[model samples]
Target: MSFNVALSGLNAAQKDLDVTSNNIANVNTTGFKESRAEFVDVYAASLLSSSKTKVGDGVLTAEVAQQFSQGSIKFTNNSLDLAITGNGFFATVPELNSLETSYTRAGQFKLNQDNFIVNSQGGHLLGFPVNADGTSASVSLSTAEPIRIPTASGAPQKSSEVDIRMNLPAGDSFISSAPGNFDPEDPLTFNHSTSVTIFDSLGDSHIMTYYFIKDDPSVNPNEWMLFASVDGKPIDLEDPAGGGTNPVGGNISGPLSTGGGLTGARLVFDSSGDFQSQIPTAANGGIITSDFSNHLPNGADTSQTIQIDFNLDPLGPNPNEPTQFASNFEVTSLQQDGLAVGRLTGIDIGTDGLVRATYSNGTSEPLSRIAMVNFANEQGLKQVGNTAWKESITSGEALAGEGGSGTFGTINSSALEQSNVNLTSELIDLISAQRNFQANSRALEVDNQLNQTILQIR
Candidate 1:
């Protein structure tokens, strides 16, 4: 009986040492929780035995429990790295579309070949789909899906409208040459010129330069001539060779006619340098249309018609719009409604677990919202490998929610949670367990010595 008791004591001490050693080994592990070994003393007595004199039997290993406390967050440079401040776990899946799920506190994640966010174990990070306004479409865990980032944005759209606000100089001199004899290459032909890049249907850029030439006041008072060209090609008002409409095809055969120096729109301003023309609501504010069709780089839409809007807002009143002031000729603002396909620039994770992806085209959209889960009994969770926990019979059902909501913790981007194991405490436990083993061994040796003495007496 003494031998059995000492053997049990030694086994209990060894178990304590093993638990302590494991804690020390994983001291630097991410999201690792420390464990403790518990024991209870056994007694040799039956139900009908004497109640006053009961002898102790041995020590028995009762249970090994885990400690689930908050770990310290270590900030990193990677934006995908995340850390939870309080209680909650990030739900992950083993494969891209796999429904078999796993929970993790380690937030070290990166993009895979298919632009899916995954962990070191290739587990896909699951998230709820979000609306365009950055709100979660559904918060249910069953509705969660793997987060994927698109390589590029939508298709390219051709430039159809241009909004420009400019201040034309009232004190500028008129062109020395007549409108019919004006040349785009010569400086004295046009008073001022401003150019902007516009996109075609195939995402090709075309330089659209607007030349503002001050006209002769003797011919037309408070008026200016606006000459426009695309890629240095003169937009003809009427065919110079023939008095018919200029057809848009292959290439121009001869010089374009400018209606005998009355080719472009006449900017008729009031005497006070204020605009008096009512800017209409049609395309290009009902002013002029530079309609043309030319072959694109990749056989895209060639029939491109761009309306140049002079008024800032087509619907609003033309109060202090583009004016012919006494100041220098300057383009205050110019904007177009065309965009080329954009590449993925970066991603951002908010405290609310919202993942927003930004593109190179100066546009951003919400991709998904990370789902956070919490169990009623964290210690009751079964220890799976790689610093992860699994749902066990002892652990209650997982309650899913977004980060920073209720009992769930908030997500800290660019950060990671370190192991909660205390090295110093583990070392102390190691020493205590070693002493217990030595004491048990000494008791066993004493028992053997007493047995030898009894045999010598017999």
Candidate 2:
């Protein structure tokens, strides 16, 4: 019995030493959690034995429990590296479509050949689907998919409307009074000119130039002629009310010209330099709509129409309306609703686990939301290799949630979670286990000597 007790003590001491050595060895490992070796005293006695005289047996190894605690953060330059500041684990899979999910805290992630985000062990990181507005569509783990970045260009959009706000010079001289005198090649034909780039249906760029010609003050007082040319070709504006000949030019022979010159829209202003109305009343609020179906580029949408809005509101006093102020010609704002095809530039991950992709066309789009999970009992998670764990019976079902919500922590991009093992404490434990092993060895030697002495006396 004494030999058995001494042997059990030796085994317990060796187990303690092994646990301490493992903790010390993984002190610098990323996302490593230290473990402790627990023990329980073994004793067996019959009912006939006296309780006061009963002797206890040796210690038995109960279990090796892992300590789930927060690790220190180590920042890096890679944007894909992630760290959780509180409770939560990043869910991953062995392959792109594999459903065998494993949870991990190690976030040394990089892009694979297919642009999917993966850890060092090639485990694909899972994420939830996101809406157009960067909101997560679902938080369930079953709906999570591997995060993949697109390498192609972003979607292109054609120009539909343009908003212009400017102050027309009130003191400018009338450059032309004769009809059909406006020519894009000659500067003297128009008073002022401005150009903006608009997109076609196929994401092709076309220059839309606006030429402002001050009409003869005596003939059309406080009025100006607005001529537009797309890609150097004249475009005609449809009258808001009905069909009517352009006041500046005689009639529209083809798309936007009469007698080889571009016809112009009449801009009428009040005495106080406030815009009153247009001659043709093309659209409500003096907005003009031009159809470029006759002059669009090859393989482009021929029915595309662009609305040129000068005033935001027609009935109310709008400060964004065009003015004939006595100041110099200055365009306060000029914007168009169009987007060109863009190449992928970079990616950004927010603290709330939202991933967004930026393009060279000055556009940003939400890609996905990283999936996070937490178990009811973190210590009960079965250890898989590579600092990952699998859900077991002891550990309750994985509860999926978005980062930075409820008890889950915010994800830190370009950072990693270091090991939580304390080196100093582990060293002290090593010394204690060594002493225990030595004492148990001495007791075993004593037990062997006593048995040998009893055999010799026999």
Candidate 3:
């Protein structure tokens, strides 16, 4: 009986030392939990009708339960490196078709070739996917997709119409009466060259030139001012100061750009008696139009629409005019509107476990509010690898809750919780385990010696 008791002690001591060794070995491992060995002393039981016929043997090993106290989290420079605070584990979705859900505390992640956020094993991180409005509820952990941070918004639009819209000051130069009778056949012309940006059918952009010369009379001595419109609105047209007032010569004048000179047509009385020109000629650039309001059947203003579409196909028989694009742009209002363009810089976890991302545009957003779980019997949890545990029949269902609620602790970013293993306590326990094993071995030796003496006496 004494030998049996010593044998039990030795077994229990050996188990205790093993558990301690494991704890010490993984002291630096992330999310490693220390475990405690539990033991139960053997009891004698009666086997006869009075229940006193037999006695139980020695001690028994009850269990080696793990301590689930929160481990400290250290900050890593990688934005994808994540750490969970409190009791919750991250849900992961494997990339392959094999349906398997894995939970982990290791937040290390990276962007896959397709820009998917995935772990080292290519398991995608799970989270409620956000919509264009940045809100969602139809998603779950099992169906979470990779959340990609966008670099830019939609494509830049082409200039369908080049609109030069401005009120050219009605200057004192206008004789008010004499300037109104300006004729195109005679010659007092203001020649100017203006640059235009045009876009091709493939959305490629190009530069085009428009030269204007006002045909006024030399006898009038009044300089003729030519107005230029790119798409629909009037655009700035000025030649290199030395290019003089004529950007285009006589043979290349008017909307047609044909070898022939401009044909004079009757300036008509419109339905509103407005002085509307009868000829489809585009003086300067094209008839000033706003929002596609201008009309000319055979004008340089092609069907291209806007200035962003200004490029023409020189390959065509007549590159000057098949379908002209409109170019209308207003830059005054751009400065007036308070707009912001920012990029995501970094993300930080709050003490309350909220992940907040900062942007280069001086803006920030809450990525998600972290969730944690608690259990009725933590000791009953079945330990899985990687500092994670799963609920078993012994451990009750996980009680999911937010941080700062119940016994759940709040998380701190940039700070990790240190291990609960106290070197001093471990050292003391190690010494006790060693001594206990030695004492049990000595007792066994005594039992052997006593048996030998009895045999010798016999």
What TM-score, over all chains together, does every model reach?
0.82, 0.92, 0.54
Candidate closest to the true structure, highest TM-score = 2
- Rank candidates by TM-score, best first: 2, 1, 3
The alpha-carbon RMSD values of the candidates against the true structure, listed in the order shown, are: 5.3, 2.7, 13.2
lDDT of 1 by residue, 346-377 (tens): 89999999999887766777889999989999
413-439 per-residue lDDT for model 2 (tens digits): 999999999888999999999999999
- Whichever of 1 and 2 has more lDDT, that candidate is 2
Model 2: lDDT to the true structure: 0.85
> Which residue pairs collide in model 1, if any?
none
- Model 1 C-alpha RMSD to native: 5.3
Error of 2 at 74 (Å): 1.1
Q: What C-alpha lDDT do the candidate models reach, one value each?
A: 0.78, 0.85, 0.49
What number of backbone clashes does candidate 2 have, counting pairs of residues 3 or more apart or in separate chains? 1
Q: Return whichever of 1 and 3 wins on TM-score.
A: 1
TM-score of predicted model 3?
A: 0.54
Clashing pairs in 2: 240-282
Stretches > 4 Å off in candidate 3: 47-57, 93-99, 112-115, 119-123, 136-289, 292-376, 397-419
